[model samples]
Target chain A: MAELTYRDAVIRGIAQEMTRDPDVVFIGEDIGKAGGVFKATVGLYDQFGPVRVRDTPISEQAILGAAMGAAMTGLKPIAEIMFSDFIAVCFDYIANEFPKSRYMSNGQVKCPLVVRTGNGGGARFGAQHSQSVENWCMMIPGLKVVAPSSPRDVIGLMAAAVRDPDPVIFFEHKSLYATKGEVPDGEIVDTLGSAKIVRPGKDATILALALMVPRALAAAEKLKSEHGIDCEVIDVRSLVPLDTKTILGSLARTHRLFTVEENPRLCGWGAELVSIAADEAFYDLDGPPVRITTPHIPLPAADLLEDIALPSVERIAERVQRSLQS
Target chain B: MAKLEDRAPAPKGSLNDDIGEEKRLALYRTQVVIREAEQRAYDLFLQNLVKGTSHLSLGQEAVAAGFAGAMRPGDLSFCTYRGHAHTLARGVPIVQVLGELMGRDIGLMRGKGGSMHLTSVEHGVMGSYAIIGAHLPIACGAAWRAQYKGAKDVSVCFFGDGTTNIGAFHEALNFAAVWKLPVVFVCENNLYMEYTPISDVTAVKHPAADRAASYGLPRIVIDGNDADVVYRAAIEAYDKARAGGGPSLIECMTYRYSGHSRADPAKYRPEGELERWKERDPIKLYRERLRAFGVGEDAILRIDAEVKREVDEATEQCKAAAPPALDILTTDVYADGGFAWRN
Candidate 1:
């Protein structure tokens, strides 16, 4: 195992994939010479040259549309939106274009495309940059949505996303990019729809994603030490083909659920999880599922105000303790 | 003014100098086949045989016929929603094209993609996008691949006059120009973008033709309704792209006889605009030109009758085709499995 940053893991995964497959090409704004604003795609431009590592105009619509086209043909294209918030600019491309072509084309064409974007709150780039919109990718049927919380999950899911036949939205948390973790030395091709129990216990179940995964884990540790609550934390690696079995099993054992997210509580991913658990494992629940999320307001620039806006470790632990008491 | 009989004159001498009677008649045959097939699709739609809405390229056959006719077999082409003519001209089988419109299992795209998304890689028709100018970048990507792989194939993107205003058009044009990719952006100016006239929507005198100069590439503004005119221009652009001279824009001035879809009747068009363009119909003009090139009237009539019969049989073939099974709906959502209905 090697200790690597989440960002470095992403670059390593891309380099290994590009080396393995000639058809895998990268396209985005400033991803070439600029090495990406986050520097995740650094050193790739020199290695792959201009044709494979393309620098595109500042039109996400065109970038994604072209990537969709190239994916339909023969290339396995990895398109990066500089920020996840800019996905709205390519609304038609995502909501209407790349997602529908495969199903709409029946079985004739395959879209082996990966849309990589940096998401999450903590970075304080304000509302435009500090947003987690994985739900947008989930709404589309053919598209796969995956968010990796650690360096290991990043490499595994990145491999799966690149290899997948349909389009996959890889939402990496910008704040977690610097977080160091132990990742396997060689190739790690993890399944997309499988959720992992980062911390397991029996008192309650806490489902978190991306940046929230670490917070949920920290809360779980605190709950065990202070309140004598044995909380199980499951990182939802892939949001689209959700790991229903793991979530249901965890809920059946814990008999309580607290879904955490950085996105607004209204119509967030937590709502979907609640619905899934309610429908499939209704009798297994001890109480109505609780949701701990950021309020439905734009992210503020000030650090203290932003801290108040988003859900914190203490807030998550208190919510779980309250759920257990109730 | 030239006499009405010789209104749609053949090109003076751009690339037409090499086009002999055989190729000229072939071009005429392609236009006839497209026109007949479009009329057949319209008739089917009227009879309630075609499901969903079908956009027929009634009078704009010359643009597709000329463009696709001039393309080499290895070349790739992408087009807009009203693209039956382009796909047909690219040599997609009549039965399969009709199967797509009729929503049958035998469609080129397995009936999933109806009229707006017909694709046949075998015929090099990449796809027909329903969005206005969304597929322009996709076409550029195909051309970029061609350049990357050291292949001689050039990519062509066909869109309407309105697509020029979209940011995708500018982005795609600028990308192709910057990289000098092997591509030909064909703008089929069919007079209107749905209900509004092109004049009301665009600011410039020539909306799409000026894009070439803006992007620092060669431009061709030709009479799109004239098959020979479009054909000559298409040949020049294709030649330039294949020679690594970078991308070029060919704006074909054409008109459509039908409404935007099956819904509108296009009552918004100005007085006598449709009739004036219709008098210089591409098929009529090409047929007269074929006669002047020493082709007998019997040859033109024979080709027309044969095409009419072919379209007639293809319509029945489409109607007879069965819809895909229920299980297929649950399947093929993902190529490399993430989530399937069984899960």
Candidate 2:
């Protein structure tokens, strides 16, 4: 029952988890005294000491590999990679070792690790600092992918990520960090792999994730006000263990669907969702599902170019209108 | 050899106690076991009993046997492709190990893991990854788990001198050093990363041990052919790690007598190199040390007979063991009950 930003909520969730479990520690490049580049771990170093909130070298491979090592041994580690673009540097560790350890060992080892990184392109940090690579991670098995759009969802999903027995990739949108929302003061745990209904409607469904959730909601409101379109908005909080039940249920009611994502169009998370819908809810669909996503190009440094590159509320609304008309 | 005056004093409290008669005999027996087991595996490979390639740890027996003896049951171990000896040293049953190599259903990993993928979690041997330098990160992860769980256990990762050149090794070592993780990186410098000699690839004189200082970790170089020396060095490293003194890198200078895998005949080695290494045969040296320490010849003979009998029995069991059921091919790719995301 307190107003908090997405960054503050994440910091509170990590601090709460560290307090509850001494085994939970944080590690990243500037997460210690600097409190993280986005300040997601602000005031944690002072409260938990350097051992808990560790400052690591500027080696993403080492940070991720060490986090996997720590998680497999016994500690519940929440490692930060600063930006999602840097995740490419640690792909071998994540794809080859972390995901394969449990299955290769026949359930003898479990990697209860959470890799938290800032994603999406709004601040125009160019191609390197701003990118949404959640789809790249989704291709790997044994990993759970989560992207929360709001501060409340961030806190709830993060707590669940910390407690889950599997490795989780928690992507925080760079644009959503400063966005204010009402987060529950007491402990709140949202189940992973479950979608939440952000706006209930009957005409069509707009499924979104991370920074796109607010855009989807905005599009839904605009469609209702101007075009008299009743659009349902569903926040896909977790992408890997996707809440297919909730999505299909919503699709069953709406009979039309469109997915909105900040990542590029080709082979993006939207493609996966569309495939799943085609496979499971084909008969329920009245029209081919649409996808409103960023163009298949690197995020540009200029604000105008980046704005055009990312999915916009107007574009999402237009896509909803097209899906309904089709 | 350098003069005594010229040599630096062995790091204080680093040297282990002298290997007594019983320990020396034990070391000889373990080396023989490894040699015989590896030979039998090669024989099986020739007969098509084992599928895929086999990497023999024939000449490097002293390193595996010695370090394995120093480890407690709860300590963790990760090794490279040439890992049969390390697995045996970690107390994996000869019958199960041989069965795995033979691709039998009763084998470790339920016959899924072949010669290079051997694993025995019950014995604290996580796995032996086939990829060079891949398991270093895994070892670091396990060590991090140990420290996080507040367990006193230590993790030992065994790799070849060649793996030190890989990025994964550097990443694992740097993290272990920075976080002060309880891990010991044991590099079995067998003079070659496959057919290429260490000197040809690495500019540093001591390719394995010299790299430890780069990561701010204490380094030790030892005569890998000597079981007593390897055992002492490994024990010290493991002890320091378990005591929360952070990580250490130990380079065991040894030689591989056989080909890198089953494909090559090791023709690349220069004349007299193999002979020179054989002159320092660890099993023979330990046996002589045992005899000089008053262990009866009768006792040594009895021990050798016992080990031989065990190997013979394991071979028979492996040959008789049936191939894995075809249904297992679909299993173990994901955790049982299916992945939550997929199903």
| Candidate 2 local lDDT, B310-339, one digit each (tens) | 889999988888888887655443444345
- What residue runs in model 1 are displaced by over 4 Å at the alpha carbon? B1-17, B336-342
Interface RMSD of 2: 2.5
TM-score of chain A of each: 0.98, 0.98
Error of 2 at A302 (Å): 1.4
| DockQ, prediction 2 | 0.42
Task: Give a tens-digit lDDT track for model 1, residues B1-343.
Answer: 1211344545443334577766787798889989999898888888888879888888998889888888998899898888899999988899899988887888777677899998887888888899888889889878877877788888999999989999889988988898888989988888788888888978886788765788887556788877777777788878888889988887878889998899999898889989999898988888777766667899989999999889988888888889866566655677743236214
Per-candidate TM vs. native? 0.96, 0.93
Candidate 2 accuracy as lDDT: 0.84
What is the per-residue lDDT of model 1 for residues A136-206, given as tens digits with 9 covering 90 to 100?
A: 77877787889999999898899888988778899989999889999888888888899999998998899
Q: Give the CAPRI rating of model 2.
A: acceptable
List DockQ for all candidates: 0.56, 0.42
